[model samples]
Target chain A: MTKVKDIGEQGLLERLQRFCPPDVIGDDAAVLVTDPEQSLVVTTDMLVDGVHFSNATTSPEDAGWRAAAANLSDLAAMGATPLGITVALGLPGDLSVNWVESLYQGMTECLQQYHTPIVGGDVVRSPITSLSITAFGQVHPNRIIRRGAAQVGDAIVVTGVHGASHAGLKLLLDPQIGKHLTTTEQAALIKAHQRPQPRLDVLPHLWKILDNSKFKIQNSKLRINNSPSPQSPVPSPQSLTPVAGMDSSDGLADAVLQICRASGVGAVLESSQIPLPTAFDHWLTSEQALNYALYGGEDFELVLCLPPEAAKTLVQQLGQDAAIIGSITSDTKVLLHHQNQKIPDQVLNLSQGFQHFSP
Target chain B: MTKVKDIGEQGLLERLQRFCPPDVIGDDAAVLVTDPEQSLVVTTDMLVDGVHFSNATTSPEDAGWRAAAANLSDLAAMGATPLGITVALGLPGDLSVNWVESLYQGMTECLQQYHTPIVGGDVVRSPITSLSITAFGQVHPNRIIRRGAAQVGDAIVVTGVHGASHAGLKLLLDPQIGKHLTTTEQAALIKAHQRPQPRLDVLPHLWKILDNSKFKIQNSKLRINNSPSPQSPVPSPQSLTPVAGMDSSDGLADAVLQICRASGVGAVLESSQIPLPTAFDHWLTSEQALNYALYGGEDFELVLCLPPEAAKTLVQQLGQDAAIIGSITSDTKVLLHHQNQKIPDQVLNLSQGFQHFSP
Candidate 1:
């Protein structure tokens, strides 16, 4: 066996160096040239073999997509436009070139959809396959939305229906679940589990909706310029900011609690108001549906709080895609309202989430 | 063993979510807020156990420093100001938390020197230890330099002395080499081999010298800037640019050839003009010195081409540290000039630099 020292550091870097294009390969960092005025957004996600994906069930392509999507969804959740990404891949000795190419193909396809480019990365030999992706995006500086900004009395909105991914995962892990579903249905669910689509389409219109809300929130804050089509005045940092926001990667209920904790507030979620996929109902009971809606992880949807005055315009702007699932409250607790009865707050404590070491 | 599926995807994400502070951890990526007007620069480096470091010789702290330095040097080479970093670590099942903390401490100490924060990262179990760091810096977009900008008639400039790292490695791997040196000298060489300091201080002054050309050359189009200043103007898109420019990670000779290939040009490097550490002469023969300087990797110094007009100012700015090591020629070959004789060109057909796949 060739020991690592045999190749040396220079030799290792040179071999991996050829895998990257020179334009962005060797610099201190790869440059993603965006319009100077835009705010650069960045996010990173890591995947470990056997922890995030199983070699028994997942192809290398699926593993790559899951790894990339996990990071890309973070960009989508912030409503930031995709820019560029760097991949850090760890491969075992038995890994083949074909596996790496397939993985790259999956990553490249996703990147192409969002117009993000793979600028540079590092490849190293490991005892097991591990992958980490750091993705970059650009958005207008003032328009860059954050998870901590959601407000009290604002409607909580989420993009896309939830729970199918969790259901698909269950089916993938237990073939018995697959026995009940039609072949096409099982395939659809499995695909959803493997390749979750990041919601990039909603980003461009996010700031516009927020701006319209600002006008409703405080009429005095709106200063319309007379030159040509006047633009809305830039809002002060303290005014009409998002009071509470989070991505529902850990299920809507878990994310809601996180937002509440960060903002020093509570929330009242209407159980009936939560969106569930039609396929989800076919697979699970109403209680299971509610459980999944509240706690199913990997939804990759945003759960946001907007002030009441801004809620109407925001909903109108988002159309049917965005839902009003709850409202932020002064009480420092997360409450689930089912019908007319209020259930005791039950917080889900995740011992580990998507971590490699915990299990 | 606790299977990863038991925790599930959302569960795993939620488990590790607490490691990231809410203020910086955005839904998509960790949002590191630096100076808003400055352009965000990004770089990544990955290290695997048995590949980049060995259990026999490297400590956890040394591994951490080397990993951070690898990425940090990329930033230093770009002339960008370091800001923050995210780390993704993969560990074996039996790995200890104490080991992880020590690694973090080493990384923290290095990053703290430049005031770079650990914004976020993910950790997972692997069969062997692996680490990946994605570092972010800020620079002016127009000032961001690239490798393909070297022009003809431009003087070639390198930062600091080369061969120290290669010699240091040789000494570390062969304990017999240490017999000739004092304890402190041996320790210094070992430390250099384990934890090389990236030249962050020289970046700010790089463009000043390159633009002025204190080094001598015949052609003027290829201007390589590896200094860490964010204010340098970006080369024009249409600029014929550097005949060739690269970081001396894989020996100066190999890097020069890379530049030659990139710019469709050739180079002639003078041996006596090249700088070398005094200690290196005793350990290595003149021929070995030449070979190390030519093909040895991991020096992390910048090799750049500049026009003749910029050579004087470049040397004046860099002072004694800068050397006019080589010049670009239209002949499309890399030649050595020694004792007033032209040595025959040597071809490095196989990528002779460091690779992650050897083991």
Candidate 2:
């Protein structure tokens, strides 16, 4: 019957620290001793209750899972290996201890599965509930993927299904729309929205392609040399690296534009080439489905550019779930290329995200 | 004038990056290549509007100063050196670009003055404006300080003024409280509340003291036999170390209670030994002034345990600015002694802080 307030902030921290791994909490700051050769990668993301998740519709566990996943996905996009995560939570006084504990449990589920430890954190009294997670990771100098390295002739590739989370979000927000889907279908969509996976497993292949591409002028040379030689240290024959990459948090089109803007190149995305959610046709019109695939956001899928052969090999190794979505170009404009002629329309729309300060 | 919405999230980041120095703001995460000899020390803190600071009473710069100082004080408590910081901001729309820019300027003034780079960050749209900062530091394993290391015989030392900020907060909330004070006194109190300087500079002296103390925890076992021998290296004749440590973010009594709980030791605080602002007596009784010194928070001053000789040396080195306020004891309760008697009452109240989840 101990309320968080009853014990006080320090008491609550002591209680939480009892369950957390020893040496991680109860210090001014957690200490991490890492490999000297590796570079530390850090990314931060903030999730506000009403903005990122609806407390009425989502459990604390789900909210925690989603927030951690968002930052983890950023690391995965950079081909970085997870190290530790530091969280800062601002909470309302009325929140239950059970809710906060469940939230930590959800974050631990994802972070532990990936070997990322929860190191240290701060909790403050806030009128509105909010959490900010700063995730630490490590990536080899040469293996680090950037959004600006795509070449003009490289092929665009993406992993996993796109827009399922968007579909799931719509269903979660509107039970009326979800009523049309089968119970199993509804559950799958809801799961996508609640627990999108970070693509930590796909880094090896992505790094290989980048190593082979050898744009050494723009990149720090990796420990592995991928030049044509008997000693050529290609990680795997099927595991190819991409020229450039980023995660699709703001949908495929927006991610592509980010790559283009960074690389000083344009892109040509084929609508037919994109792998949309299987239940898209059952839920909406073709245009709406396309919109979701191109600009719906929160897929957590990495989008990268590879040589045609390397892209094909990557797709083959990653299975039918991964596919070639498009190609890089010199036009400096991102265009949606459907059947035959170019669609002459911007692939990414300005109205895609839950714009925080929308007028 | 370009509103933040015009650039959108990505565009605003780009605009900010233009002035934020190269390699600080463009990546998914910044890569920190640090010295291998030191351990990575990380701490995170968040400031919420209406919770930590108010848009009505506080300027963005003052809010920035307090937030940065809080995290910096934590690092200083551990005798760690500042490395860099990553910020995650959650902002409502209709917030002026000018306001946000000024906020950054304030943060930059503090961080840059300390040579701690503003490394990487994320900006998100939220219904309420808030900011979370994760700061990185490095500390030597041999010199690492902990709150639980206080010994029974040690002088409790603290740097800088106390209760001034609390008085300043009171004045900020209600201007009428300042009517009796001279303009100089009012300005001093207001400045104390607005800008609590982080004690990062005091770290060198602390580390030297700890190194001299040479409890020889791990490395000593590796080198020194710890038995009476000529081979044993006791560091210095004059430079001595404190027994344990922490910063006073939550006032002296609470901090003393925390050290007691952590170290399984108690403390004896003589009211006569306590220091107060000179103007305090003119405005309030001696009891009220003592209460403010013992219970007022956010001083960002360090409260550490030291030997009498070392405390003298520190006071001499730091001038009259540093004071030996109390001592550690075998008794397992914190006692506030006045004249010759220990006050038989709770030294600290549980309801003191801005307790979140309070019923």
Candidate 3:
């Protein structure tokens, strides 16, 4: 069988070099810059093949899309304008050339959708395939957002729907579950888990807020490429920011707890206010759906802490895509307030999410 | 047994938060900036646990040092000024907290030595430990070097000692054979393998060459901040770049081959001029030593092709820290010329280095 050893390092790089960002592949380092007023925003993420995605359930392309999304979401959380990305890959010797090419095609799709390009990278062999992506972006220094600045009375609003990725994972892990839902529902759930849409579309709004000037994406030259990703939802332009900002990948409750701990404040979740996927009722009860929305991970939706007026305005602008799920308080605990007729209120002593080290 | 799940994501972050750069840990992304005259230069590298370093031979800190060195060396190859780094880590669930702490300590030592602090990153669970570091630096846009730009008659120069890491790896892999070596030889070899210095000290000289004007690190006010890294040589204040620049991670000959292939030229190495490690005489003949010097990997040294005048000036300024290794030629094949009485000259058919995917 042909192996990476046969192709050699340079051979493989040559195969993939055309996909690299222009003016990047052949240099010791990629070069980039922005206006002096903008600070460079950077973050990185790594995804292990087995731990983050199984080959049986996820195509190489989906893995690449998700890897780029993870880093892009971090930049989106800061209202940063994405500039470029560098991908470092660890791959198995037996990995086929086509698989890698497809993977990069997926990355290209996401980067084009977001308007950022791949800069430069290193590829080496490992026992299994894994990916590490570093995303660089730009933001006005004073306009940057952080998770530790949420005010006690800020209203917590989230972008987009939740629990779809969790449902998708459940289906991917068990094909038998596919019998319980329609083909459309199954496809939607699978897509949600495989693809994540970063909140970068909100940047134009963020600019408007930070600059205290009326701004509209339609009025600006910045094009909103509305081409929906196979793994993500269709685009909607509603966006806003508050005292603090966080992109939820570790589930809703855990994110609340994280913000509370970071800001030394408490949080209260209105369980009834949390949005549930419409088809979740087909296989899951309303209560179970809320639980999945609460504790399931990989949402990529943003949870923002804003004043009551800002939160209300953002929700109005976002229409039904978002809801005010919670509020901050001076108390030092995160609690859930369930007003639903089907569920009882509970003072959540624990807000757990995806555990990286969980067996 | 405590799992990473036991500590929870936030708990793990808390353990690492103290080591983060200022205003970096709590944010969605870290912010950095360089003056308008300079462009941001970025590079990334990944170290798989078993592939790059094994726990059997490398301590957590050594692995950390090596990982950071890989990326830092890329920036150094571009003559970029260090600014910050983001390290994404993938770790096994069974890893100890102490191991992680110690690893960060090693990264801290390397970054402090290079004056690049940790900015931001994500830590996730994987089957084994793997680290991905993103190094961000600043460089004058007009002066940046590329491997494809080497002139046919340019003189090639290399910095620091070569093949020591290879000798060190040999010792590390076989302790039984190591018993034959002197203690001084053993220590030096092991040190070379375990600790890699990124060569940031040579930056001032690089600045001088690139700008065509004298520049001193002391005048920048960026702060040297070096407490001395165990793996790095003492401050020598010497470095340079030319029309083409590449770091020697894949042995001298392989790097030369890469430059030749990129620049559409050839190279000729003067075997008599190449430097050998001090311990070569203890275990092998001069021929074997020279082979290692030519074909061993992880030297973390830079090989550059400069105009004759620039090469002469840089060599004079750099003194013994660098040497004129060879010259680029119009011919396409890389050749080695040896006039030494100990060995006959040989045409290198395969100037192979450590192959990442070799079976």
Tell me how each candidate scores on DockQ against the true complex: 0.15, 0.14, 0.14
Q: Each model's C-alpha lDDT?
A: 0.62, 0.68, 0.68
Write one digit per residue (lDDT tens) for candidate 1, span A94-208: 6655566677777776777776666556666666778888887765545445554545566788776777678778888897966767888788777777787776666655555
Q: Pick out the ten consecutive residues of candidate 2 chain A with the lowest summed lDDT.
A: A23-32
- Model 2 agreement with the true structure over A54-76: per-residue lDDT tens digits: 77768888888888888889888
Error of 2 at A294 (Å): 0.8
- Per-residue lDDT of model 3, residues B1-359, tens digit only: 33333454234335433322332212111222234356677777778877778888889888888877877887777767777777777766566655666677787777787666676666676776778888888766444555655667778988777888888988888878777788988898889878877766666775566456333322122113322224322333222224577788777877788778867788888876777676776786766777677778788888877776667777778776588888988888887776655444444545243232111
> Scored by Cα lDDT, where does model 3 land?
0.68
The alpha-carbon RMSD over the true interface for every model, in angstroms, is 14.4, 17.5, 17.4
Name the 10 consecutive residues with the lowest summed lDDT in model 1 chain A: A223-232
Arranged by DockQ, best first: 1, 3, 2
TM-score for chain B considered on its own, for each of the candidates:
0.75, 0.78, 0.76
User: Considering every candidate listed, which one attains the maximal DockQ?
Assistant: 1
Query: What residue pairs clash in candidate 3, if any at all?
Result: none
Off by over 4 Å in 2: A1-36, A174-183, A208-242, A281-286, A307-310, A339-359, B1-36, B174-181, B213-243, B281-283, B307-309, B339-359
What TM-score would every model get versus the actual structure? Answer: 0.78, 0.77, 0.76
